[model samples]
Target: MTGTPRLDDPHAFIRAHTALMAPPMVPEVELHLAVETVAIWEQTEEALGEMGLPPPFWAFAWAGGQALARYCLDNPAIVSGLRVLDFAAGGAVSGIAAMKAGAATVEACELDAFAIAAIETNAQANGVALTTRLGDLVGTDDGWDVVLAGDVFYEAEPARLIGGWLETLNARGATVLIGDPGRSFLPQDRLERLAEYTVPVTRDLEDREVRQAKVWKYR
Candidate 1:
C-alpha cells in the first residue's frame, strides 16, 4: 500500500510483536502498539536487510494523535456524517476516532509499508472501516469535510509544505486540524489553538513520560 518495500508477512510480524492497547488520553480507540521500541526497530532492520526499514512510527500512539483523538471523541459534531482525511497517518488513531465519532467516511495516507499494514490491522481491530492511500497528497484538494494530521511537523521542508497546504485547504472551506507536541518545525504562527492535553508516551521513544500536546485549527 506504500512506496516502501513490502515486507514478507508484514501483518503477521506486527501482530506477533506488538500489543493491542489504547492511548491514555483517548481510551475509546485501540491501537497495536509496540511493547518496546528497541526490539521493533531491530526487527525491522533485520527483516528489511540492506535496504533497511523506516522507523516503526505506526507502532506507537504519538502524543499529538492521542490528543486529537480525544478531542474528536469529545466533540463528535466536528466529524459526524462528514468525509475525513488523516494525512501522514501512522497508527490511524485519528482516522479511527473520526469513524467512531460518526464520520460518513474515513481515509488515511502513508508512505511506509509497515505503517500501512499497521493502519489496516489497527482499523480492523477497532471494527472501523477506513480507506487508505499511499504517498503524500499535499497539493490535492480532495474536498474533504475535515482533514486530520497528527505529530507531523517534525521536519523542516515537510512542515512548511503541510502548513502552506493546510492554508489552501482551509480557504476552500475544509476544516483542517493539526496536532503537534510542540515539535521544532511546527508553524505555530500559521494555526489557531483548539485544545491541549498532557499525553502519556513511551519514555524511550519520546525522551519523556508525558508531553504537552496541542490541537490547532488551520485558520
Candidate 2:
C-alpha cells in the first residue's frame, strides 16, 4: 500500500509484484478468461509481449475499458464528485479511473468471485477505494448517477439482458455508457457515440487487426 501506483498516475503496473502505475489502476488490467465462462477474454492466439497468461484464463483489460478510463481522465467534468456504478467491472479499470478523476465513490459489480477478488486486489494496488459486489446484473437495483459497462454485449442472452438494464437505467435518469469495440450484439442505434478509438487487439483473441471501440451514451 505504501507506493502502489493509482489510476491517475499515468504509470503502468503490469506485474502483480511491482508498483502500480497510474492512480486509477495497475498496468496489468488484462485477465485470462476461460472460453466456457462469462469472463472477458475468449482465448489468446499469440504470446503477448511480457504479458503472461496465468493458469486456465487470461486476465486482461479490453480496449473499451482503456478508452473509457482515458476519456474520464481527459474529461474530469463528466465524473467529478458523481456517484458511479461500474457494472460488470472486469479488471476494475474503469471504476478506478472514475475514482481517480474525482468521483465521490465507486461500486463494482460482477458475478464471478474471482473477478471480485481481482477487482479488490487491483484497487488496493492502485491505492483506490472501491466496493465490490458479487452477483448477477439482473438483480442490481441501486440507483446511481452513472453506470459504466465495457465490452459486455458479446453474447446473445447476456447482451439482451444488459441492454434492457441499460434502457431501464436510462429511463431512471441515470446516465448509462458503454465501451464497445464492435461486439456482435452492440446496439449502436440505441445509443449515441461519444467517442471512438482504434484499439490494438491481439489476433489470438479475434481475427480482426484492431478493435475500433466506441464510447456510447445510452439513449
Candidate 3:
C-alpha cells in the first residue's frame, strides 16, 4: 500500500487514562484522531518527551483543532465535495473531520515523521482513508481550497513563517482558516471568527487547561 503507513501503539497514555476517548473503530462519515498536546509555556525539556522533540514543544489536538473538528463535523455543507488540506496537521483531526463531512479528499501535511506516522495509524483506527504529505508550510506551495491550521501560532518563529506563507496563499486567493485558542501569538485582527468550542484532554496533557478555541478565516 503506497499510501498506508505502519500503525503503532499511540494510546499508551490514553489507555492509562479513562477520560480520553478511544479512537472509534468503525469506518464512518466522520473520523477523529487522538493528537498530542502540551501545556502553554511548559519547558521544552519536559514537553518534548511526549512528542519526541525539543523546545518549541509539539502538541496535538489542541483546543483550536478540536473546535475546527467540531465545526467540520457539524457543518457538512461546507466541506462536502471539496478538496481540503490540513496544514501542520499533528493529529489530522481537522482533515478527518473534513473527510467525514464529505470532502472529496483529505490530506494531512506535517513535517515530522512521527506525526505523519501517528496520522496514518489514527486514520485507520477511525476507519477513514487519508493521505499523508511531508510538507512544510513556510516555503511549500500546495493547492487547496481551504488551508486549515490548528494551534500553530504558539511560537514566534513558526508564527512568522506560517503567517508569511498564509499571506502569500491569501494573496493568491486561497481560503485560509486558522484555529487558535488564544495562543500568545495568534494574529487576531487578520481573520474573521467562524466558531468556538471547549476541548478536553488526558491527565498527561501538559496544559491540562481547557480553553475556548475559535476558527478564523482569511479569504
Which candidate number would show the highest lDDT if scored against the true structure?
Answer: 1
Highest TM-score against the true fold, candidate: 1
* Candidate 3 C-alpha RMSD relative to the actual structure: 6.7
- Each candidate's number of clashing pairs is 0, 27, 3
Q: Each model's TM-score, in the order given?
A: 0.93, 0.75, 0.74
Encode model 2's per-residue lDDT on 39-129: one tens digit a residue.
2222221222124322212145577776787677777788898989988787678888888888989999876554676677677766789
Give me the runs in candidate 3 sitting further than 4 Å from their true place. 1-60, 202-208
* Model 2: how far residue 157 lies from native, Å: 1.5
In candidate 3, position 146 carries an lDDT of 70
True-vs-predicted CA distance for residue 10, candidate 2, Å: 27
| Each candidate: RMSD | 3.6, 8.5, 6.7
Estimate candidate 3's alpha-carbon lDDT, on a 0 to 1 scale: 0.65
Candidate 1 clashes between residue pairs 3 or more apart in a chain or in different chains: none
Question: Which ten-residue region of model 2 has the weakest summed lDDT?
Answer: 41-50
